[model samples]
Target: MQAYKQSLKHETFSYLPQMTPEQVRRQIAYALAQGWNPAVEHTERGTPAKESYWYMWKLPMFGEQSVDAVLAEIEACHREFPNHMVRFVAYDNYAQSQGLTFVVYR
Candidate 1:
C-alpha cells in the first residue's frame, strides 16, 4: 500500500515579488478600467492555512471609481497587519468571478 500526506504550509509556493505602491495603483487602475472591483486580504505570517484560504479583509464592491480609495485601503491594510502577508483581489462582476489577484506585501 502507498500512503501520501498533504502538507499545509503557506510558504509552499513563491509568489511574485512584492509590489510597490505605484505598481499596485497601476494594476488597480487597469482592473477598474476593465470593470473589475478591488478587494483586499491578509494572513498571519506563520499560519498553517494555505495562501488561497487567507482571511479576507475587504470584499469587492462596485461604484468605487477613485484610485485614491483603493490606495487608501491598501495602506490601511498594511498598517493594520504589518507582520502579515497582504494581497489585492479584483472581481469581475460581469463574469461573476475573480479576475486578478496579486500580493502587495510580504
Candidate 2:
C-alpha cells in the first residue's frame, strides 16, 4: 500500500474588521480630495485563485464628483453581493493601474 499526502489549505488576505458605511464614505471623500476616482469590486470569500480575482462592478470614472455617487455604487454592489466581500478602489490618474483599495463590506 502507498501512503497518500494531503495538501494544506492556506488562508487568504482580508481586513480583520470590515469598514462601515460611514467609514467608507470618509475614505471615498479623502480619495476624491486627492483626485482619485472611485470604483467598486466584489468577490466571493475564499482562498485566492485565478477564479477569485476581484470582479469590477463599476469602472473608475470621474464624471460624478460627489461622494454620494460613489457611495450609491457601493450600496448597489452590497445589494448585489450581500454575502461576498466588497471593496472600494480609488485610482490616481497619474498612478495609472495602481490604486488604493479597502474592504468596505464582507
Candidate 3:
C-alpha cells in the first residue's frame, strides 16, 4: 500500500462572492473526487464583517509530489470568477515536502 499525507493551511483572501466557507468546503470535496484522498481542509477568517479576508483550502497528497496537479484544479476553480483569491500551503509528514500557493482574486 502507498502511504501519503495531505495538509492544507489557509490564509485570508480578498472579498469572495458568498458562502465562502461552503465554497471552499465544496472545493475540497471536489478535489477529493478527483482521484485524491485523505484530503485535509483548513480555514481562517480575519473578521466576520471583513468580506475581503476569508480563507479556506484543501490539501491532497497523492503519495507523490503532486502540487501541480492539486494547485491546477484549485487555480482553475478560482479563475472561473474574476474576483476570487485563494492561498494555501501543502506539505507531507516530512519537513522536506512542502509547497505554498497564493492565488489572488483581483
Best by lDDT: 1
Model 3 over residues 3-91: C-alpha lDDT tens digits? 42212222333233433545554554443444333222322333334433434444455553354555565565466533444444344
lDDT of 2 by residue, 14-53 (tens): 4234556677688788888888788888877665563247
Worst 10 residues of 1 by lDDT: 5-14
What order do you get sorting by TM-score, best first?
Answer: 1, 2, 3
How much is 81 displaced in model 2, in angstroms?
1.6
Model 1 lDDT at residue 104:
74
* Native-referenced Cα lDDT, model 2: 0.71
Q: Would you list the C-alpha lDDT of every candidate in the order shown? A: 0.73, 0.71, 0.41
Displacement of the residue 6 alpha carbon in candidate 2, Å: 19
Higher-ranked by lDDT: 1 or 2: 1
The lDDT-based order of candidates, best leading, equals: 1, 2, 3
Model 3 segments more than 4 A misplaced: 1-59, 62-64, 92-106
- Root-mean-square deviation per candidate: 5.2, 7.0, 14.1
How many residue pairs clash in model 1?
0
- Per-residue accuracy of model 1 over 1-74 as CA lDDT, tens digit each: 84433332223122345556777788889888988888888887653445447788867656688888887887
